[model samples]
Target: MRTARRWRHYLKPLVFALCLAPALWLAAGVRWPAWVDLGANPVEKIQHTLGLWALRLLLATLAITPLRQLTGQVEWLAYRRMLGLFAFFHVAAHLLFYVVVDQQFAWPILLEDVAERPFITVGFAAFLLLLPLAATSTAAAQRRLGRRWLALHRLIYPAALLGCVHFWWQVKADIREPAAYAAVAAILLGWRLYRRRPRPAVTGAAPTPARGSSRD
Candidate 1:
């Protein structure tokens, strides 16, 4: 445990860099279009990439628990918060890019998209749900919220489901990618439900009366 704890000090930085790399790469593509091609439709490419990473990281965050249980390495939990926050980070960037770049901050059109477009509606809902989770992810917040914290965090399950639906709806066809994500999410969430299922109470049988003893 000591070694794992010590190694985490180094590992966290590496993990953080890995999580940030996609965003950096996207930024570099924008900065050096000559070197890094963002395809013919750069705006769409960037937005999709950011949203993809959000979904990937969200699923990864959910995987940590099953991974820990399967591998018996409790240390896997150390990275959950980081991964979840990065998921929120990417999703927020995804929304910002769509609003600022795609819509040019046109409130009427953006609101219309949210209201009329099913994919956008779910995606926006997912982001709204994630907002509180990210805001309350701090240790201090967890301490302050106590048991309520766990209940609040449960929102991730629905957020993830909505994210998957958003992705599936956004894609014109070829749902294999979103299907895979949904499958993994199902397994992870199903495992959690299985674990939390109420077990039959272990009732002890009443002791037999002493042989030949009085009924008093």
Candidate 2:
């Protein structure tokens, strides 16, 4: 209906802004360096915030199909692309912040971190997997790749899994947050797999022998 379409149009921008809010908030920290002790370690704070949002948005992107199926509203698909793109943006930001600010683009140090730190390796791998997914997100690539697009997009599961592991492994003390994220990812992926499973074949019970008809 017209109302539904109007709401959808309105929601796109609203959701976009909502998604960007965390990044914008983090950026504001630069203006007020002493705001809540962020000045002391702004890089680490921004890095962690961006990384968390990236995982959250990736999980949001993965929820689309299940949401559509559950609600029977195909319109939800319209937002999935933007949501996924924002996820990639957050992830790219997270990684770039680490490489540029934290590591100062020092290749030797960066390579050492990737090689020696298990959590960093996992996070880097997750970022790498998201790269192709982001690149092929356009209509041109989708059409050109055809079935291959779906197959490539399936990489999201592994990427999300790696992200969860990376978060869990990186935590110095508590892991409840990462565990919660992992649970959410597992549930979402499980739902997707459940939806994809083939249904059992239905069969009649020998046709009931025609209920004692003429062929007695």
RMSD of each: 10.0, 9.7
lDDT of each: 0.88, 0.85
Cand. 1 Cα-lDDT:
0.88
Please give, for residues 1-216, the per-residue lDDT of candidate 1 as tens digits. Answer: 678879998999999999999999999999999998999999999999999999999999999877777766677788999999999999999999999999999999999999999999999999999999999988888888877887898899999999999999988889999899889889989988886678776689554222111111
Indicate the TM-score of model 1: 0.90
Clashing pairs in 1: none
Off by over 4 Å in 2: 34-39, 203-216
Q: lDDT per residue, candidate 2, 1-216, as tens digits?
A: 356567987899999999999998898787766664565678889999999999999999989877767765666777888999999999999999898888889999899999999999999999999999999988888888877788898899999999999999999999899999999999999987776678666685332121101110
